[model samples]
Target chain A: MEVTINNIRKEFERFPALNDVSLKIASGELIALLGPSGSGKTTLLRLIAGLDFPTGGQIFFGDEDASHHSVQERNVGFVFQHYALFRHMTVAENIGFGLKVRPSSSRPPKSEIRRRVSDLLDMVQLGGLEKRYPNQLSGGQRQRVALARAMAIEPRILLLDEPFGALDAKVRKELRRWLREFHDRTGHTTVFVTHDQEEALELADRVVVMSQGKIEQVGSADDVYDRPGSPFVFSFIGESSHLPVEVKEKTVFFQGQPIGISEAAAGGGELFFRPEDISLVEAQDALFGKVTACRRLAGTRIAEIDIANDGHAPYHVEVEVPLHAPVALGSEVRFRPTRWKVFENA
Target chain B: MSDKARTSNPAFRDPADEGFATKVALLLLSLAFLIFFLFLPLLSVFVEAFREGWGAYYEALAEPDAAAAIRLTLLVAAIAVPLNLVFGLCASWAIAKFEFKGKAFLITLIDLPFSISPVISGLVYVLLFGSGSLLGPLLKSWGIEILFAVPGIVLATVFVTFPFVARELIPLMQDQGSGDEEAALSLGASGWQTFRFVTLPNIKWGLLYGVLLCNARAMGEFGAVSVVSGRIRGLTNTMPLHVEILYNEYNMVAAFAVASLLALLALVTLALKTLLELRFGAGNAGGRH
Candidate 1:
C-alpha cells in the first residue's frame, strides 16, 4: 500500500513532537525515517502504523482516510526495537499469533497457520527451533521471530521501529543485509525508523532525513548522502568536516584570503567537506593548519587538524590520510579542499 | 583468589565475614525472636483450642452460627477477590501503559486503602449508608438494606482488598512497558486479543500473587468487617467476629477452635506464597520479555 502522511502534527501537552510533517511512501518501497533521538521519526512511523493518531491533519492509505481507523483496521505489521516477542509462547506460536488473532470468519485454519509459521521460520533461517521460547533464543533469533510474526498477517504495510537498534555491531550488520534480502523477496511496503545514518543509508531505498520534528529532505541514498538539500541534511546524513569560511562577492576566502571561486556563488557560511576531500600540499594560498592529534587504523591514519580563523577562534576537523602522510604531532601543514559545500549560514 | 586474599587480609578482617561463633550467635538471636513473637503465640492458639479435647473443639465448629460464619467468610472472599482482581488489572493497565496528568495522584488514590485504618475504611461505607446520611432515607424507602447486611460486609472487604492485585501489577507492567501490546496492535490484533494474548501472559504471575493476597485479606479481615457486620449471629458475624463472641462469653475452647482455624488458613496461605516464591523467584514482575 502507498502511504501519504499529510501535514501531521502531534503534541504532547504543549510541546510538539511532530510539527507539520508530511511524506509520501510509494508501494513496495523500503524507506527509512532517519533522525536523531527525539526527532519524531518514531512518532511518524507510529502514526503510519495506526499505533497513534495525529493531533492535526490526516493519514491516507492510497485514497482512503486512515485518520480514524484503528490499528486493527489499518492492517499494519510493526516490529518493535526490543523484539517484543511474547515470552510465554514458543517461536512457532509467536509467528502464528497474527493469524490466530484474526476473527474466526477470516482467520486461517489451524493447519494452514501451522504450515505458514513453519514456512516463515524457514525464511528467517530458524526452521527447526519452533518449540523454543523467546528467552531461550539469541537476540538475533528473537528479532527474526518478531519479523516473522509481523509478516504472518500479510499486512498492508510493515513498520519497523529500529529493528536492529538493540543488537551488537556485528549482529546488527548481519541483520541489516538479511533484512534487505528479506524485503526484496517479500516486497512489503516498509518504513523503518533509525537514528544510525549508516544503517538508514545502507538498508533503505529512500531516506527521509528529519530534524527537530520536521522533514529536512527525502531522496535516494546517494541524493541525501551527496546533494543534501539543507545544512541540517548535510550535517546529519554523512560524515563531513566543517570549517568556518567567509564568502564575499566574487570569491570564497579562508582566513581573510581568497581560496576558491566556485564557492563564492553562495553567501557567507560554514564550508563542509568529507575527510577524503582534504589533501596536504605546499601551496601559499592553502589554509594553514597544525596536526593536533593522530590515530592509527588498519591502513590509514586519522588526523585532527586545528585550522585558525581570521578571528582568534579555530575549527578542529578530522581527516583520514594515507599512513605515509606527514602528519606527526604539532606538524604544520598547508591543505586545500577538493570538494566542499557552502551552507550559506554559519 | 581466596588464598591470596586471606593472606593479605590476615589482620584486615571484614567484620561481617563471621566465624562459627558469630554465625551461631546470629542464628540463636533470630530463633529466640521467632520463638517469642511468632511460634509461641501460634502454638498457644492450638494448645488452647484442644484444652477441652477434640469433642468440644469439633462441637464448636458444628454450631449453626459457626457454620454460618465460615460460609459468610468464604462467600465474601469469593465475591470480593474477583471484584478486586478486575479492578487491579484495569488500574494497572491505565497507570502502567498510558501517560496522563495526575497519574501519581491516581496511584496514591489506589493506595488509599493501604494507608487508611480498616475502621476508617468501614466507616466510609457507614457514612454513605447510615440512616441520617443522604440517600439513606431513599434506600430505606425502597426496602434496600446496605449497612448491617451482607452488602456492607462485602463492600468493606472489597475496599480493603482492592489494592492487592494492582500493587503487584503496576510496577511490573510499567517496567515491561507497552512494547508487546504495541507490537500486537500493529500486527492487526484487536485490543481485547492483544491483552489476552500478550499483556496478560506477561503479567500472569504478578496477577496470581495479587489474587492470592486479595483472597487472603478478604477471608481474614476483622477490623473493617466488624465495623459493618453488626454482629448478626448467623448472617453478618464472620469467623473473626465469631471467635470474639465465643471468647467474650467464656467459651475458651470454642473461641480458640475458631481462632485455630483462621491460624491454619493463614499458615496455608503463607506456605503457598512461599512455595510460589521459591518456584518463580518473583521473576519478570516487570515483564522482562
Candidate 2:
C-alpha cells in the first residue's frame, strides 16, 4: 500500500521531534530513513508503523486516513534494533505469534499456522532451529528470526528501526546483503531507519536523509551521494571537508582568489568537496597550500594540507595524493577542487 | 600464592583480600549466629510441637479456637495474595514500560507500606474506619463492620503484604524492559493478549516468587492483624493471634502447636521461594534477549 505522510509534526513536552515532515512511499518500494542520532528518522519510522502518533498531521494509507489507528489496527510489521523476540518462546512460536494472535474469525488454523511457521523458518535459512529459543541463536540468526516473525503477519508495510545496529562489524556487513535479498524477495513496502550510510545507500531503492528534525534530502542513492541538495547531506553521506568561502554573483571566492569552479550565489556559503576531488600542482601563483602531513589512511596515500586564507584563519583540507607524490610536510603546493558545492549560510 | 592455587579453588579471593585470620573469624561468627538464631529456633519448633506426643499435638491443634484461627488465616491469604498479585502486575507494567514525571514518587508511594510500621498501617485504617474518623458512621449505619472485624483483619493483612508482588516484579520487569511488549504490540497483539502471552511468561517465576512472599506475610502477620483483629475469640483471630492467646493462657502445648503450623508455613514458603530462585536465579531460564 502507498503511504502518504502529510504535514506531520510531533512534539515531546515542548520540544519538537519532527516538524512539518511529509513523505510519500510508493507501494512495494523499499526505502531507508538515514540520519544521525536525534534526527527524527526513527521517530518518523515509528509514526509510519503506528507505534507513535504525530501531534499534528495526517497519515494516509492508500487514500484512507490512518493517523489515529493503533498498532493493532494498522497491520504494519516493525523490527526493533534489538531483536526483541520473546525470550521464552521458541523460534517457531515467535514467528507464528502474529498469526496465532489474530481474531478467531480471521486466524489461520493450527496446521496452517505450523506450516507457515516452518516455511518462514526455511525462508530465513534456519529450517531445523524451530525449537531453539531466541537466546540460543546467534546475533545474526536472532535478527533473521525477528524479520521472519515480522513477516509472518504478511503486513502491507514493514518498518525496521536500526535493523542491523546491534551486530558485530563483520556480521553487520553480511546481514546487510542478506537483508537486501530478503527485501527483494518479500517485496513489502519497507521503510528501515539506519544511521549507517553504507547500509542505506546499498540497500534502499531510495534514501531519505534527515537532520535536526527535518528532511535534508530525499532521492536515489546516487543522486543523494553525488548531487546532495544540501551541505548536511554532502558531508553526512560521503567523506567531505568544508572551507569558508564567499559567493558573489554566481562566482565562488576563497581567500579573495577566484580559482575557477563557481555555481549559484549560495551567498557567503561554505565550500565542500570530497577528498579525492582535489589535485596537487606546483604552480607558484595558483591557490596555494602547505602540506602538514602525508600518511597512509586505510591503505590509501592521503595528504593533509593547510590552505592559506589570506588574512583569515587558515583552514585545513585532506586530499588523497599519489603514493609517490613528493607532497611532504611543509611543501608549498597549488591545488584546486575538481568538483565541489557551496551551500549558503550553512 | 601461585596462580594455580589461587584459581584452582572456587573460593578464590583476591590477593588484596582480608587476612586468613579475619576470614576464619568471620566464617565462625556467621556459623555460630546461624546455629543460635536460625537452626536452633527451627529445631525447637518441631521439638516442642511434638514434645508431649503426636496425640497431644493433634489435640492442641484440634481446639476450636486454633482450628478457627487456621481457617481465618487461610481465607485472608486466599483473598489478599491474588488481589495484590493483580495490583502488582498493573503497577509493574505502568512503572516499567512507560515514562512520565513523578514516576519515582509513585514507586516510592508503592514502597510506603513496606517502610511504615505494621502497627501504623493498621492504625491508619482504624482511624479512617473507626468511630472517630470520616467513614465510620456511614459504614456503621450501613451495617458494614470493618474495624475490629474480619474485614479489618483482611485489610491490615493486605496492606502489610501489598508491596511484595510489586517489589518483586518492578526490578525484574525493569530489567526485562518494554522491548518485548512493544514487539508484541507491533505483531498485532492486543494489550491484554500481549500481557497474557509475552509479559506474563517472562515474569512468571518472579510473579510466583512475589505471591509466595505475599502469602507468607499475609498468613503469618502478627503485629498488624493483632492490632485490627480485636482479639475476638473464634472469629477474627488468625493463627498468630491464636498462638499468642494460647501462650498467655499457659496452654504451652497448644501455643507451640499453633506456632508450629505458622513455622511450617514459613518453611514451605521458603522451600517454594528457593525452588523459584533455583529455576530463575541459576540463569537457566532464557532471559531477556
Separately for all candidates shown, the number of backbone clashes (residues 3 or more apart, or on different chains) is 0, 0
lDDT of 2 by residue, B1-289 (tens): 6789987986887868897799899999999999999999988988888989999999998988889999999999999889899988899889998898999998999999989899899888888898998898899999999998988988898889999999999999999888898899999999989989998888888888999999999998888888888999899889999999988999888889999989999988899888888887754355632
Global Cα lDDT for candidate 1: 0.87
Quality class of the docking in candidate 1, CAPRI style: medium
> Which 10 residues in a row give candidate 2 chain A its minimum summed lDDT?
A279-288
Stretches of model 1 off by over 4 angstroms after superposition: A309-313, B1-20, B282-289
lDDT of 1 by residue, B1-100 (tens): 8778977888866667888698899999999999999999999999999998999999999999999999999999999999999999999999998898
- Mark the regions of model 2 whose C-alpha exceeds 4 Å error after superposition: A249-251, A264-266, A308-313, B5-13, B282-289
Residue B100 miss distance in model 2 (angstroms): 3.0
- Residue B238, candidate 1: how far off, in angstroms? 0.7
Tens digit per residue, CA lDDT, model 1, A21-134: 888999999999999999999989888888888899999999999999988898888998898888778889889988898889998899999999999999999999998888
Best DockQ goes to which candidate?
Answer: 2
